[model samples]
Target: MILKIFSNNYIINITKSLPRGVYRILPSEEFKKDDIVVFEIPEETKKYLFDRKYVPSIVTSMMKKVASEKIDDVIEINNNNELIINSKNWGKVYKYDSYGRKLPEIDVKKMKVQKGEIFLLSDYSDRSFDGRYFGVVPISSIKYKVELFFRF
Candidate 1:
């Protein structure tokens, strides 16, 4: 994963496969009338697997099994490059692995500031030791965004 921070916002590019079942991989740069950009994983990429044959088939099956779990949110890239996500609600944070034992209370709704560090949120809970547990991250730590190039 790469994150490029501009003057006001940031662009994130992911090189690795998304967290198992992320529906949207790369969002389109174009803007629709609704002022939202849609993202979809290419059908060819969706059906292609690296080495495992059954993996792709299984993933396809799981996709059908959990169709409702897909996310269809609107993302707006501002002039400053800041991504304005207009959707059902604000973002959510899951709990971290370590937090499972300590069980820290994280209030996602109250989280206002963007930390400088890479805070790993839990996949299940929000109250976990993420940036809140450690400290603020420095802007210099950010790198480049991931860019996926397609050849026609």
Candidate 2:
């Protein structure tokens, strides 16, 4: 099994099956109701039709397009404490105090993002299965940014 680290979390292979699916991992507290997450299909399994590379992207794009109207503003703070605002609609903005802070328990109504934390975007407006379904995904699950792929 190949292991990947996203942020400070770890994504590992487990033999047991989960309610949502077959794979499972420890998630971060920051994972909320509808955060977008990427799952990489193992190289050995790529031959299957379900392993298509564009599947996830197409889903993400469609989700973004449908939720365009509900998208909220994203506020980014630069190193100099300058706040940069992007007009594009996003799920939500979360602030973390430091790089390795654990995600807090879900309390969407009362929870506020802390400084230095990451801001996550949910995939849809409806109660679709996502971060909320599985819980916050640990940063370790991320293997690396999807750069390029070569199929054998």
Candidate 3:
């Protein structure tokens, strides 16, 4: 099924991690904010996911779009589920947990991105396994940047 779902670097996502569509991934020397990139899961998170059975053992990669406004930016979330970067409205995120349970409105997080790290969020749907589950990933982890032309 994966063979039929992809060709070369092209991959079709059945999940709404990035708008629930196909994306063209390719090797790149660099990527900018808002560019979706294919990358490896951070080892710490991967282990936690495996130990907790949050993610299957077969999961090896992840697709996360860079959302940090820039290096050394601070990210904040309000009760309204808004992703505020550097005091400016950048985007929104899911307010509910995956199990349809109500989560704390006032997210106790004011994350500041550092050098060689990025802030990613799955803002398309409330059920994405991202949000509080994922945080500041290292830049060196990225493998390919997705082409924005494929409904990215």
Candidate 4:
């Protein structure tokens, strides 16, 4: 579905089958482990996602549009300082060296997802730039929990 925010509209393709029960909860409600939600992506994360292509190397690649508002499937929530996300498409991850230049983090295998962080994953999991690349998100960023209903 294409949702417009501010002036930009974001297109999120919902493909999951709705479970047996469908309900909505108050914002004060606690989040479950596998809840699918819609949340506001921070400006920093939006910029990070936007500038991903031009970071370390300026490759003239065709850039796809990413939005600050996301409909994500929650993976792990705040427990320590980590959130393990499973976004569909992985992007170029940049980490600063001692010199402060943009460089790829080189170690996706050893990278650890921490607690107290709100990491999000794309349901597609094959073409998303999710929490793994952007690191953990804050718990306060989540907006609502939603359920999908497919009528076929």
- Residues forming the 10-long window of minimal summed lDDT in candidate 1: 61-70
RMSD of 3: 4.0
**Global local distance difference test of model 3:** 0.63
lDDT of 3 by residue, 34-122 (tens): 77777788887778657766567777677766777365666777668666766765456665556675543434264556777766655
Error of 4 at 65 (Å): 20
Task: Estimate every model's Cα lDDT from 0 to 1.
Answer: 0.27, 0.29, 0.63, 0.40
lDDT of 1 at 56: 35
- lDDT by residue for model 2 (32-117), tens: 32333344333332332124332333221111011111124334434543223353333332332124433223433332334322
Question: What are the candidates' C-alpha RMSDs?
Answer: 16.0, 16.6, 4.0, 11.5
Q: Is candidate 3 or candidate 4 better by TM-score?
A: 3
Error of 4 at 49 (Å): 2.9
Worst 10 residues of 2 by lDDT: 60-69
Give the C-alpha lDDT of model 2.
0.29
Q: Give candidate 4 misplaced runs (Cα > 4 Å).
A: 1-28, 52-116
Residue 15 of model 3: what lDDT? 55
How many backbone collisions does model 1 have?
9
Instruction: Score residue 120 of candidate 1 by CA lDDT.
Output: 21
- The TM-score of predicted model 4 comes to 0.44
- Which parts of model 1 are misplaced by more than 4 Å? 1-105, 114-137, 149-152
Rank candidates, lDDT, best first.
3, 4, 2, 1
